[model samples]
Target: MKKTIIVLLTQLVLGLACADTIQLETGSFVTITLPSGWSANLNTSRSNEKVYWINLISPEKNENAGKIALDRLKHGWAATEEKFIEHMSASIERLSASLKEQPVSLNELKTDNAIILYQVLVWEKIVSMITGAGLAEYKGVGVIHIRYNSGHTAMITVPIKTLDNSNELNEILNIAQNMQISMPLSENKEEESAQSSIQITQNEHGTVIGNPDISRVSLLLPSKNYKATPGALAIGRGDPGYFIGRDMVANVIMSGWFSPIYKFKYKTARDLWKKDTPKQAKNLEYLKIKEWDVMVHELEIPIKTQNTLQVTLRANLLEDGTWIDLRLSSMGIASQRADMRKALIDYINTLQVNVAEARGFHLKYTKQGVIINAPAETPGSLFIKTKSLLLQKRKTHIKTEFFLFQDSGEDIKVIAWLRPASDYHYANVKTLWDETRATLSGEGFTVIGDTDCQKTRNWDVMLYDLKTGDKRTRNVNMRASCVSGGIWVDVHFTTVDQRDSSFLRSKLLAYLKNFKVSDSHVE
Candidate 1:
């Protein structure tokens, strides 16, 4: 599936980026310079004739204060300035009808290369019904139509009230004056499709092998023919995976993890393939081997040794989240075709996966409190010294203890919190989640996606995904309540790298699943 790009202008204003250029998933390029407290998301999934748009949001108070949109039209429009004005008028008419109020146009500017129009809408905003107070709001909108002679047609809408006092309006006008739009070259499209098919987000931790979506299982790749790069054994060996093939050098990366059922959804392999099978994929099919259902597909990926390599991917996501991903690729050469086929078969037949539970440490404090099976130390990874802290809410205090897991050079913390049973603030799981989300939000973290709540045998579990304002860091929190113990517990699994997010989250869930409330412990 094509992914949407959300870019924050704060990075540009903070000097982390010097006028960055972003490429949309639809093969269109966008270059914009904006001030802080603004963020943009590109959407190319419009229902009308492949219309591409960028939605801009400004910092809000009380409610969303500013909204701006810029869009590139694909077809059905005249180049004349009059036609553009008519389109704007019709759009305003629709908005007026939806709001049940008439808006007045304040100003207009027509130039050889662009057209700008300003409008104002007057409305009443409800402040407080208890105090019988309301305020009149004047919202101003600016529309800009750009005339590109190269057959590219586009329009931009901005919030006039927010930009009236700052230089930001001039900067936005500069973008309209100098914007350039073009379709990506054919070769670039193919490369992008190939990269999307693999769906691995590269990070600083060695070469990312296999796919993050199916991170559970591991494959016993042929080792004699492949050598591990220095210090990369902690994560995945080499970049991506090791090279294979006897007569012809081919690439292969295999990974799998054990679980109780499939990772996301899809009851069958065919169903999974139908859900996200890339457009460029070939020979898409499903297979079954005793207890495992396998989905297979092929794509042409660009490589250094050749213009393109035909890659075959075999995947099996089962046992809750347990999965296996095996990728084999051969450089496009007529002479290597036969050898590649034989090598692929050999690798598949010889593939041996040892489905075993991960090693972990059974940890507890004072014979009770929060008990969990923390993931044990593996090669190139270790747990640092445990730490403790206290958080205050009103007159209540919650004690927190945590262990930091460090792999290769990257690190993530696993925190466990102990709260009083009579805190009342967390009398139930729903209130627990509300308190947790509110606290995290106050600390500058935004909850991502939907927060989930489920009931276990002896505890109520709540899962949350959170990210920072810049979207660079992420935390997966699991909060649980013991049935009889006079304490509440939660674990925060935090990671800065996207590649490790899934792995760390799964580990946290494992801990939650094995959690126990000891009878000897009392709050």
Candidate 2:
């Protein structure tokens, strides 16, 4: 079977010198050489089993009835050689029937590296689905399936008029035969030289944006045809690590935001402003690439003076407490959309994120001048600000909260409250703890006894044994505090059962051990 496939493909094979590689948004890659005057566009925004499709347009546009396409198989549909041929044949037969053409023959050829299946359909006048207009000639469909040894398979389909047009068919088949497939390479594996790797720290693999002093990092971008630089945006930029991308002529501008993942409260980019701009905000795709979940959205943001700018926002969500947000904006009209999309995809393909260095657990609140470190795998949770008159002379209060998830139901909540000495005057750290305890007691919270108090060089600590007096769900809660001259850090731990509470308490202490508060306050 393999011998027949090899002989058939060897007979129709053509050679090309140069090749272009395309990285599919679905975490696969394809490399194929194109014939001169032929253009290729990869559609990475498809919401289907086919991860993406590469559209190949021939130079003889007037003569060719349809463009050749290579679609990457996904969802375990073409995982094996048997499944690859099974799905490809099924698709070809279904498509032929829909076009009202009889399936002439389905031939299988096997090469040393891949399994090939080609089918020729009966010629028929193809009607345009959009305009319902008849085509100039009767179109014959050519469906080819190429499954490489690397477990990557792409189904190639093109339009053919007759068997006599072997030149075009051979060219299309040659592209399929000579195509190369591989898995996406990681930044650590791909970049090894000192020139390619940015080494501010041993773990840092990519480039740093905004202020490197704060330990902000993101993917390393290409600097040949594109220019990258740190910049301030209208949206208050320094902390989020804002950077700009400019083309050779500066016709297209790209703004990127890279920061700790905890800063983004929303699940997806569309959720950021979908409620406000329902009509203008459109989610293009959500792609899962290795350890990252990328959410892409297209927005028509209105600028009061500039009318509107076409914006493409890509939110790259990394599991290790970091995210990369990129916005590609252009003032070009709708007609130039195709060109813009091609440029966007091509640029995105070049990005290689340094996952090892980018996954950081340290978070700094520049405004409050506070920095806190969490468990390596855990990211800080969202917080809702609230005001309280706990202190007698309370004029200003700021709180930072983090809910670390240990397991499915186990959670450790940590809240840090910053108050300058100018606003509240407490005789000692014990007085601050007394005020906080009184506030909780007034709010219908019962304080369990056996509480321990310790005086450390950094702060006066008060640890609560257990606080539980509610008709709500059954839960075990332990709250503690480390109060300094002007800084107060509250550590709250909760679990479903008392047995689990002990295990969670150790995790909470580990976080508190690493936690450090600087002498600087919000004063």
Candidate 3:
């Protein structure tokens, strides 16, 4: 009795250790237990054309006793159920040939949950493929092919008890048909809940918006439609109104345009014109200008309007360092001189100011000059001067003075300018040429006067130079004025050695090539 009890206990332990259960729940729940020393493979196929799920189970100890479960029902086929049945039949026939298996017989069995039709198969050799797996029936192995159709068609195979009759086969079919597969909806819900738990915080005390150091005054001429051209002024690293932080300045300008239009020019003009003239002037006849099919009663109206707009945006970097300022002005149309003046004032109000610790070696501005806060800097002081001259009839000239300065430690200066052929005031031409020479000489370049000169159909070109009061004369160019495109000037590096000079020169050329006078500054 002791020996028999010990043997029985050992068999029980082995059976418990070798048990493997697979549970599925598409609708009804069902489970199957297999020996522990077995492997299972699950495969899925999905595309725009169709979707399928196949599960294969095989014993590791008895390699030939593996079975496959396949589901091939069309995802949505209620309208053409016959087509689905035909497709399944064709698919199964092809699959059987591919597996080198001959269907032994088809048998039907009814259970408490489902009525199952199963095909028994016996093959001479096992075939392994990506689509399906086959197994040979040995002394104790049998293959049971079970297929069903509901929302989908599924086929499963398992080893049959060689000695048991059809009653045992029917029992396996009942369990397989009633098995359920769970949907992924619960997993999706859990993921969404996890994502919702995360939050983001913004720093409120870091910097204030809309403060600017330099301001801009924008004038929009009356056109037939909304048209955009290069602005009257350009700002960049090298331009006359250049800003150090190009991206910040560009953003502020663009934001100003997006804001609602305020007709401050019209309002200011009307206010000034009203104070100067009597109430009767309101009814006086005036010249009309047409823009966008809208008529303005006065050729020169007071620069006051209800739709004028301006904006100022600012950023702060540190408590005591330099601040960035950006001012944007929008003047729609100014009828009179007073209107123009008032519009300028209103536009300047849009300037934005920002403060930040300096990152680069020096702070430079075309109009404010250069400020050297660090002495060990190599490039030293760089200054730029820009002037726009309006020439009429090739004789009359109007020169606009623009200044450049250095925070006084440097011993040298360099100033470069671009003269358009359209602005040749004959009287001031000689004076401007002389000023260019004097400026270069004062900076220490040997004056090599007129190294390059050429006259195209549109304009004339001239080059001059300044050296270290020595034999070397740096070549500079001046072009005679004619009616072609407008001219621009670029001056960089008031004091620089060969290395620094080349660096500054490259930076200036890059600015000119990419720079635009238009509102769109960077591409």
The RMSD of every model to the true structure, in order and in angstroms, is: 21.9, 22.2, 35.5
**Highest-lDDT candidate:** 2
TM-score of 3: 0.22
- A best-first ranking of the candidates according to their lDDT comes to 2, 1, 3
All candidates' TM-scores? 0.34, 0.31, 0.22
lDDT of 3 at 498: 27
Q: Report lDDT (CA) for all predictions.
A: 0.41, 0.44, 0.29
Best prediction by TM-score: 1
Please write out the lDDT profile of model 2 over residues 1-523, one tens digit for every residue: 0101111010011222224433321122345666666656555322111234456667776344334333332211225677666766665665655344455478877767777788765443433321122343445556676777666666666666566676776777767777665432113322111111112112244333333323344455543445653223211111224456556553556666544454455676556534323243454666654434444455442222332335463545443444556665554554555566566655666666543342322433332223444324432321211110000011122333332222111123333443333444567656766886798789866766545456544545555544543222123444554444444455444443223444444544444454454433221
After superposing candidate 2, which stretches have Cα over 4 Å from the reference?
1-28, 36-52, 59-78, 95-101, 127-138, 184-523
Give stretches of model 3 more than 4 Å off. 1-104, 110-115, 130-150, 159-171, 181-523
**Stretches of model 1 off by over 4 angstroms after superposition:** 1-218, 227-250, 253-262, 289-292, 295-309, 357-414, 417-523
Number of colliding residue pairs in each model: 12, 2, 64
The residue-by-residue lDDT of candidate 3 on 222-268, one tens digit each, is 21222211211111211222222112222223212101011112243
lDDT of 2 at 35: 69
